[model samples]
Target: MDERDRAIIRELQANARLTNRQLAARVDLAPSSSSVRTRALEERGIITGYHAQVDLDRVGRGVQALIAFQVRPLSRDVIRSFEAFALQQREVLSVFVIGGGDDFLVHVAVPAVADMHALLMDRFSKRKEVVGFRTSLVYDHTHRWTVEPVIED
Candidate 1:
């Protein structure tokens, strides 16, 4: 992609709610041209899709924890089952199967600490694939909503 294409992507990342006309104006391109380019980007897989960042608190899930798990790597099949188990749980926001001291680092959120603990012990600990686990409560979370592409020095 060229500079203009990058600019379009950057603007979309900042505020995806912007209109086609507004995006075109911000990028200093004609409306029709901008629309065409944007559509082409979407078709070519440059722009995959758009998503909404939900307010987890409003949705009754504010608490967040980073749960690290040690898995019993007895076989590839066991590891795969562990991965599937984590994904199937509703409280698990994200799961990463990694090659490290801890086999997985799972980002989870639930209504309460009690609930989180229950999920860990009842759901996760019961699985034979899971050997051990450690959890870190997230006191606060921050996000960088906009990131500009760095030009080479």
Candidate 2:
């Protein structure tokens, strides 16, 4: 992709609701050309599906935590099982099968600290593969929607 394509992606990332005319104006391209480029980008999988960013607290999930786990006998089966179980859980927002000292990083949102404790004691503690785990309460979370990866010449 060229500079114009990158610009188009940036604008869309900022606000996916922009019309073809608006996007074209921002990227200094004609409406038809912008639409074509956008469609091509989507077809090529560079532009994925759009989604609304929701506030967890507003939706009754006030408590957020990142639970890190260290699995015993870290086999592929054990990892996959845990990942699948976590994905099926209602409280789990996202899961990362990470490396380093920890095996998995699970982001969860719940109603309260008591609910989080219940989840840890009831759900995770029952898992045979889990050797140890730690929870860190999230006070604030911020992320950027518009990200342009550095391209080398």
Candidate 3:
């Protein structure tokens, strides 16, 4: 991708609601040219799907926590099954499988602290694969919506 492509991606990341004309103007490109470039980016799988940010408090899920888990029998099937189970849960927001002391990291949101605890005890603890887990309450969290590409020299 060139400078124009990067600029388009940067602007889109900030606000995906921007109109074609507005985006073209900001990136200093003709509307048709911008459209073509955007389409090409999508075709190349660089520009994935757009997303909306929601307020957890307004949605009745104010409490948030990151739970790191260590599951027994480190196998591909076991790992995939755990990931699928986590994603299927209503309170789960995101799940990550990483190569470290922890096998999985699950981000969850609940109506209250007590609810989070209940979920951990009722759901996670019940799972036979789960050997150990730790929970860390999220007091304040900030996510950078806009991502800047790192160009190699």
Candidate 4:
């Protein structure tokens, strides 16, 4: 992508609600050209989706925790199954599969600490694949929404 493409992406990242005319104006492109470029970007999969950011605390899910788990067998099938299971859980926010002492790290949010404990005992600990796990409470979380592409040398 060139400078115009990058500018378009950057502006969209800041506010996906921008109208085509607004976006074109910001990127200094004609309206038709901007629309075509944006469509092409979406078709190429560079722009995947738009989302609404929600506050867990305001939504009644105030508690957050990162739970690291070590699953048995460590096969591709087992990993995939575990990931799918985590995603299906209501309390789970995100899951990460990594190569390290732990096989998976799951981010969960609940109403209270007791709820989190219950989830660990009733759900995660009961899973046959789960052998070991650790939990850390999340006090705060921050994210960088806008990103610029890195040109590889």
Report lDDT (Cα) of residue 124, candidate 2: 94
lDDT tens digits, residue span 1-153, model 4: 888888888898888999999999999999999999999999999898887778889999989999999999999999999999999999999999988899999999999999999999998899999999999999987863345553532
Error of 1 at 78 (Å): 4.6
> Which residue pairs clash in candidate 1?
none
Judge candidate 1 at residue 27 and give its lDDT: 99
Estimated TM-score per prediction? 0.80, 0.87, 0.89, 0.90
**Model 3 C-alpha lDDT per residue in residues 1-153, reported as the tens digit of each score:** 888998998899888999999999999999999999999999999898788878998999989999999998999999999999999999999999978899999999999999998999999999999999999999987773445563632
Q: Quick one: best TM-score, which candidate?
A: 4
Q: What is candidate 1's lDDT per residue for 22-122, written digit by digit as tens?
A: 99999999999899989988999977778788877889889999999997765788877888889999998888977768888999989999999899878
What is the lDDT of every predicted structure here?
Answer: 0.86, 0.92, 0.92, 0.92
Where does model 2 exceed 4 Å of error?
142-153
Per residue, candidate 2 scores C-alpha lDDT tens digits across 1-153 of: 988888898888888999999999999999999999999999999898887877888999989999999998899999999999999999999999999999999999999999999999999989999999999999988773345563633
**How much does each candidate deviate from the true structure in C-alpha RMSD?**
2.8, 2.1, 1.9, 2.0
Which window of 10 residues has the lowest lDDT sum in candidate 4? 144-153
